[model samples]
Target chain A: MAFLEVASITKQFGNQLVLDQLDFSLEKKQILAVLGRSGCGKTTLLKILAGLVSPDRGSVRVEGQPIQERPLPERGVLYLYQEALLFPHLTVEENLGYGLKVRKQPKPQIALQTERMLYDLELSAHARQLPSQLSGGQRQRVALGRALLVQPRLLLLDEPFGALDPETRSNMQLFFKKIAQQYQITAIFVTHDLKEAVNMGQQWALMEKGQLTHYQQLKDFSKDPKTGLQQEIAFWKKIDHQL
Target chain B: MKSSNLLSIGLVGGFLLAILFLAVGSLATEWRFPALLPERYTFEHWEAWFQKKAWMYYLVLSLLLSAAVSITAVCLGLMTASGLSRDKRSFLWLRLSYLPYGLSPVLYAYSMQFFYHISGLAGTWLGVYLAQLILVYPFAVVLFFTYFDSSMHHLEDQAGSLGASRAVVFQSITLPILRRPVQTILIQLFLVSWFDYGITSVIGSGQLKTLTLIVYQYIGESNLIYSSLASCILMAPPMILWLLQPSRSTKQDIPV
Candidate 1:
């Protein structure tokens, strides 16, 4: 059984059917990148998996149980929006401790965990500062720290690097890839940049108009002699060049 | 920059003139504020205000209504803004609540009287509070919603994901973030409650005598000096706080 599975998930936003019987699954300690053109249901699918939205039909299961049945901030599901969504009123330590505070964890424990997160994510020096004080890259790093401090079982990132400049974004992506491996945390990331999806994800799922049309290993996509995959790779290579 | 400053000066100057005219009329009896220092000034009228116990009652009345209106208006504004921030179903209703706020308060009072009369709420303390809530909650909602819908919306969602329960999210994130706007609305509401006579006279039914109510009543008695002093006292707190507020949204890096 997979660690997470979104099976036949269907969703509609008013008149538009966003996700149509989409199915995908992932293993533990794997990074799954969801790639799609704009207006596809990549975000919708990520939100559904994160339990931020409910699917119209079908279910998202984690470790063989449906995630929908679980309560918020439970089942260790976290969604990192395209924007960092840092709490404007909280400092770095306070933001990291937000989840711990909500869960009623002990103060010493929260302090310990926040310290670990700050040092681990290279955010210790910026801990006293607010989100607005930090540079774009620094803020995103704090956002990651906040998310990681929650000790979430599954991390759902909705273009977490969406706002940074190309140089910053490229560096952060490599930094994040390293962190994701070191922590051995399962993650689903959505992005328009195919190079990011290709290089970062162990598994890549292509979404087209809400449907998960393709799911394959990155090795398979890169190594397949198929002309279709080759063209897709080439197209993203051009984009990567421009970026 | 200079033009805006001049406009502000002019606006203050115009108000000073009107007040000066009123004061001049009052000082023909006793009140005074001359170009520099008054050659002659008497507070026999001011002493008379303290000597009158009715003034004390009017102070209490004004204080009660201001407290009632400001607290309830702000609370309702916060809750409604929070509800509107998340729930889109009542967007039209939320938008419509603000419509009357743009209309003249006199017109609103003119329209509100019939309902108060029918409901037997006329001339009641409850009636004044309700009227102020109706008048001010919309302003509060507008200000609060605008703040919420901005980048603050993202913080709200992130707070939810961060293990804050819906209630926790409200108290921990929403309320704290809203301090600046809520404070702004609070001062504005205090002024509105202190000076509002349209609904006060219409709904007050000659019984719910607030400071403004008594001021106008003093004017009706041809005691303009007495009323001027009374109005000045009534306006003090809001006047003080308005000057005290941080002039702009205190800007620094958003501490998240």
Candidate 2:
């Protein structure tokens, strides 16, 4: 059985269909990148999977257990937004410790883990700084550290790096890849950038009009003409010939 | 920058001058026209006022009423705004909240008095509290509405997904995010209830005597010293509230 399975998820907001009969599955410790344009219902799918929103029809099972009916905290799923939504009032250390604190973990254990995360995020020197005091890249790192500290069963990322500059985004992508491998994180990464999907995810998919098409291999994703990879490559080749 | 600094200093100077005038007027026995200062400054008025002890009772009553009204209004407003902000009909509901402000407080109180009378709450402390709440609750809701934007909602959802339960999210995320706004609204609403006389007089029907009512009564009786004393008393709590306000720099990053 798959580690996470979503079947026939359908949602509508009045006359507008936001998500329609969406289906996907993820194996343990595998990252699935879903590429889509804005208004393609990628966010809605992530929200539903995170249990932040309810679907009119579908079931989500994590580890063979139905999580659709579970409360947000009990579902063991964490959703990260495009912006680094850190608690402005909390210091870096405090934000990193928030999840464990809410879980009623021991104070010493929280302190120990939060300290470790701060070091891992390379934000130990900024342990006392508020979110507003940090740079964009630093803030995003803290956000990721906070989510990972909770050790959620599934992580839903909704274009978390989309707000950063290109250089920072590239660095963050590498950072995420490193941490994801180290922690064996099972996650669904949603983004609009096709190159990002190919770089960041082992499994790839494309979403359009609330419908999803999955590709099991990089070659398959590249071969899919709808991806426009051929056109981009041909344009680059023509430029190379002109040069 | 320089002009703004001078303006701030001028405002503070004006406030201090007003307080000094009130303090001197409260103590003066007789001060004729054109006198720069009172000829005879005595503690006679203060002694008499303290001895009568009526002001103490009115002071406590005013404190209790304002505290109850502001606290209840803020709590209700926060909850209502949270739910209303996410609703499709939020704009309509918020527009309705402003209806009370269209009618003057006195007129609104008089209009609402019938229900109080029929419910047997008129002329009681509860009656006055409820009347002030009616005027203040909607104002609180309007003030708090801006704080519940999409980003705030996203923060709450993120907190929830981070293994915080609803209660935990409220305590940890929502309340902290709302701290500055809540403080601002609480103080503003408290002052609204504190200095209120129109709604109280109309609703209480001369049975309840808040500090504002007593100050007006002293003025009507042509008792300048007593009125000045009452005015000074009335301004004390709000001044203390001002002093207790959090520093501007400390709240620089209050989350929307």
RMSD of each: 3.7, 2.2
Ten residues in sequence with the least summed lDDT for candidate 2 chain A: A225-234
| Clashing pairs counted in every model | 3, 0
Individual DockQ of the candidates?
Answer: 0.56, 0.63
Please give the range of 10 consecutive residues that has the lowest summed lDDT in model 1 chain A.
A220-229
Residue-wise lDDT of candidate 1 within B1-256, one digit each (tens)?
6999999999999977866755654454543445453445575777776888988887888888887898888888888887787775667867787798677887888788999989999999898789877888787787666666646666776777778777888899877776776677787788888889888888887888888877787788977676677667766676688787757653223433
For model 1 the interface RMSD, in Å, equals: 2.8
lDDT of 1 by residue, A1-243 (tens): 989887889999899999998887889988888777788988888778877788889988889988798777676788887777777778888888888889899999999999998888888898887777777888788888788877788899888888889999998998898788778878988887877888778888777877775556566655644314577868889999999
Query: Which CAPRI tier for candidate 2?
Result: medium
How accurate locally is residue A224 in candidate 1, as Cα lDDT from 0 to 100?
44
lDDT of each: 0.79, 0.90
Off by over 4 Å in 2: A241-243, B31-39, B249-256
lDDT of 2 by residue, A163-195 (tens): 999999999999999999988999999999977
Name the best candidate (by TM-score): 2
